[model samples]
Every structure is written in structure tokens, then in C-alpha cells.
Target: MDHEMTPRPDRLALREWHVDDAAAALSVYSHPEVVRWLIPDMDRVPGVAAMRLLLQQWIAESTRITANGGRWAVYRVADGRVVGGAVLLPLPPGDEDWEIGWQLHPGVWGQGHEEDCAFTLASLAFERGHSEVFAVVRPGNTSSAAVRRNGMHWVGETSKYFGIDLQVFRLRKADFDRTAPEGHQPPTYADI
Candidate 1:
């Protein structure tokens, strides 16, 4: 578990958010293009101060996150730059189904960051014993292609999770296993 939690010096890494990441996080959250595709409830991060405050809140709330889930800051291994955020958590209302999501800086868009985040988190979820994981994208959002690239199947739309219509895609453990590289294991959240 200790080894699993340690940040990998690979193409990308996932670890818990840090206060100093506000500026990098802002790069992802404050952009109009990124914000426009996010869930309706989330607004543009506004500024670095606001991004810092949000990171603080997310860090505090992270402690209460379930053992199999967490909120993480995505980093580019080559430059150690914060490129985005990733999360794998149970959906709201019933909290029975898990959801996998990521937000990347516009500069890194279409560079496999989204797919890496999705596959890593989905692998972690499956390794943690979940049978399936879902991704919900707002209609007309072009990011759905990344989800499909990760092998998730379109499962139709439903407003149940976020109180707004979204295109739901699902990836079963068996399906994910078929595409996952042999012996591939994502960084874990043991420290969190």
C-alpha cells in the first residue's frame, strides 16, 4: 500500500491536492472553456485566491471521503506541473454507484491526459472492488470522446446524479480489465 500511494515518476501522477496548487488548479478551473464543460453547479474558479480557498475546502473535505475514493490533483511527470484534477467518488442521493471524472488545462487538452486520468482512476476503482464506474458529461460537451477512448460505453442520459441532464457512460470491471495493460496499477490513496 505504501508503494502504491507513493507518487510515480511516470507520464502522469495523481496525489492529494496541496494548497500551493491553487495557481495550477486555476489554470484548469478558471478557463472559460473548461468551466463551460463542467457540471452546472460548479462555477469558474474566478481567481488564484478563490482557487486557493477551493483547494482548502477540497483538502478538508477529502478526509471524509470514502476509503475507495478521493479528490486528486493531476500532475505531469515530466515537468511536475499540475495539469488538472481527478476524482472517483460515489454518486449522490444513494451513494451506491461510483463516478469517475477529470478536468484538464486547455493547453493539455487532447494530449491523453484525460484518458490517463480516467483509466487510472477507473483501474483504482475496479481494484478497490467496484464492479463498474461511470462518467457523466454534459450534453454537447466534446470531452465525451476521451471517455470513449478509455473504453466506456454510452449508457444513455439521466438527471439523477447531479440534478441536471447528462450523458452517462459506463465501464464495467471486466471491460476495463480487457483493455488495461498487464500488471498495470494506478497510484493509490493510502496516505489520504
Candidate 2:
């Protein structure tokens, strides 16, 4: 029952955030193309101070989430480079389900990296005892919708903090198990 068995170290890698990753992180966040679908106002050029603050928050959140068993930094196996990040944020006070979200650099888009990362995260979620995982895609984000459709079912719609409409997709453990390709394996800690 060790969750470790679910993530293989030989294929994809999932690691923790590092201060040295600040530049790469900022590059991804500050890219207009990358932030277009995200709800945050990362479209503008954030000042040095703002960037530092954001990195600091990501670092802190990474630590906290690791302790809670719900965060990951995705890296490519071909090269030991961080490609994206994802997390399973716990539900709020009255909510009963965890939310799964991910973001990859624009350079890696259309290469199936996002789908791989999503599948890895989803597998990790199920391994850690989650009954289901949900992804909220902003309306009109076809790429994200496609990623969601790769292994999840179209559930319905919901509203975000700013009242932006979001299309909700979900994947239960059974669904993921049945849909995952044969010979598929999740990433391991050493692979990071």
C-alpha cells in the first residue's frame, strides 16, 4: 500500500520547488502566452519584488503541501529540466472534493507534456486515497479542455473567484485505472 510504488522513478519525474528555479518559474509565469488561460493577473511584467514574493509563496506552499501529501513539480525524463507544476488543493470549508491544477511552459505545449503531468498527478491523487479529482478549466481554453478530456469526464460548469465561468471535469480512481494506457507508470521520487 505504499504510495511510492505507484510513481516509477524511471519514466517521468516529479520534484520539489527550489529557489534556483525562480528564474525559470518567472519565465513561465511572465510569458503572455502561458498566462492567457490562467485566472491570475500574471500577464503584466511583475517587478523584482513581486517576483520574489511570488517565488517565496510557491516555496512555502510547496513545503506545506508536501507535508500534506498533495503537491508536485513535473520534470521531463529526457532532460532533467522542470517542465511544469501541479497540486491537489484541499477543498474549502463546505466543499468535499480536492481540486487538481497544472501549468506548463508554452515552449512545451502541444508535446503532450501537460497530459503526462496531469496523468501523473491524477495517479498520485488516487494512490494517496483520493476518491476523485477535479480540474477547472477556464472557458475557451481548448488546450486545457483537451488535457482534461484525455483522462477525465466532462462533469459540468462552475464559477471561479472573479466569477469567470469554468468547465469542470473529473476523474475517479476507476476511470483513471481504466483509461490509463497499458504499461503506464507514474513518476518516482528519485526520477526528480
Q: Which candidate is the best by TM-score?
A: 1
Pairs that clash in candidate 2: 8-186, 8-188
Give the whole-model CA lDDT for all candidates, comma-separated.
0.80, 0.64
Flag clash pairs in model 1: none
Candidate 2 — which residues are off by over 4 angstroms? 1-12, 40-49, 66-69, 91-95, 160-162, 188-192
TM-score of each prediction: 0.88, 0.79
Q: Tens digits of per-residue lDDT for model 1 on 1-192?
A: 111222334467777899999989998998888888776468998899999999999888778876788788888767778888888888886989899988888887876666677788887788778999999999999766888987899999999987999999999998886655334555554554
lDDT of 1 at 88: 84
